[model samples]
Target: MNKLLEGKRLLITGAARGLGLDFARRACAAGARVVMADILDELVTEEARALAEQGHDATAVRLDLADPDAIDAVAKFAGETLGAVDGLVNCGAIATGIGGPDMCELELDTWDRVATVNVRGTWLMSRAMVPYLAASGRGRIVNIASDTALWGAPRLMAYVASKGAVISMSRSMARELGPKNICVNTLCPGLTLCEATEYVPQDRHDLYVNGRAIAREQVPEDVTGSVLYLLSDLAGFVTGQTLPVNGGFVFN
Candidate 1:
């Protein structure tokens, strides 16, 4: 009932389902107008419509992170449509399935694709929105990384590498945009039990859960509170830091 994000306009990428959709829901609940962007157009449209039906100001945009032009276009569209975007949550990335072969057996295309979408896409989308966010005066960028990045997981080399890049980029972007009043930070969540992560091996799931300090399954909801805090005014002074939403599995 506090409406932490009141008067804010935010855009979320990869919002078709999973954590991104959860983020959209939480943002709307926090009193922010949300523009959900994802490559899955129809699904994201339904997501946006559902939020609207609930009396929340929400819209959906079809965005492909692989396309530089599409990334820029979507950021522009968000600003024009929402009047101004106060924040952006970079959650879009290629869902490289879990338990792939080791790096030696990993295909070149697989590695490249993950890096392109996860690392480059995050950089470009943040770049495209810089001007508009700066204009908002209290602009915020929350880049979604992974706990895998914090603690290197052997089987997911590409994903771990890509997420590591996201965390590094967040720090650099924070310094670059800080003068303009834009804050950039990275969120590293553990192996959350979401639709996309259902394919993860049970042992891998247990590895995260059992290793966590709290020893419980992580969920989308578990990650939302930190995300909301990062996007709200409470985190205005926070930037260039890696905040883990995992159950104390990894530290800063």
Candidate 2:
């Protein structure tokens, strides 16, 4: 209800559906201009159009996180179209059709794919957009990570490794960019019920949710508040940290 992000330009990845889409909607509701980019161009465009019809400042673009050129082009377009971006939410990721390889049975191509999109994609996107964010004078980067990485889940070895890399990279970026007034942090969510989690085996899902302290399943919206906080001015001093939205699934 509060326009906490008024006039801020935010570029969110994987915003066609799920948590990314939820973040875009909430950010716009809070008075921020939003650019929703996803690999699913049609869905993202439709979403953006719907939001625009509701009088929100929103736009959509096709972005493949696994591709370097696509990341570059989208960053450029976002800068030119939305002006200087104040926030970047790295929510774009491949999980269902991409991860779950056992470490011993993992293929090189699979490892590469996960690393490229999850790790490299986050890097490329941040690198490409740093200039615009710097221009804003109060840039914020919220990277979507996973609790699996912190607790060391099995069978999803590659994904865990990639997310571990994400957490590490966020800390390093935060330190390096601190002088520029940019805050970089990781938003680690527990096993959430989304299209991406459908690929996770039922047993694995149970392991994540059944024993959780909250006694409830995690949803996209459950993590939105933490994201909004990290991207808001309130979190100006909260950099190089991992904020877990895991319902006590994994304590710090």
TM-score of each: 0.98, 0.96
At residue 249, give the lDDT of candidate 1: 93
Off by over 4 Å in 1: none
Stretch of 10 with least lDDT, candidate 1: 94-103
**Candidate number of the best TM-score:** 1
For residue 42, what is the lDDT in candidate 2?
99
Per-residue lDDT tens digits of candidate 1, residues 105-215? 988999999999999999999999988898899999999999898889987899999999999989999999999999999999999988889789998988888888999
Q: Give the TM-score of candidate 2.
A: 0.96
RMSD to truth, every model: 0.9, 1.5
Model 1 TM-score relative to the real fold = 0.98
The total number of steric clashes, by the backbone 3 Å criterion, in model 2 comes to 0
Each prediction's Cα lDDT score? Answer: 0.92, 0.90
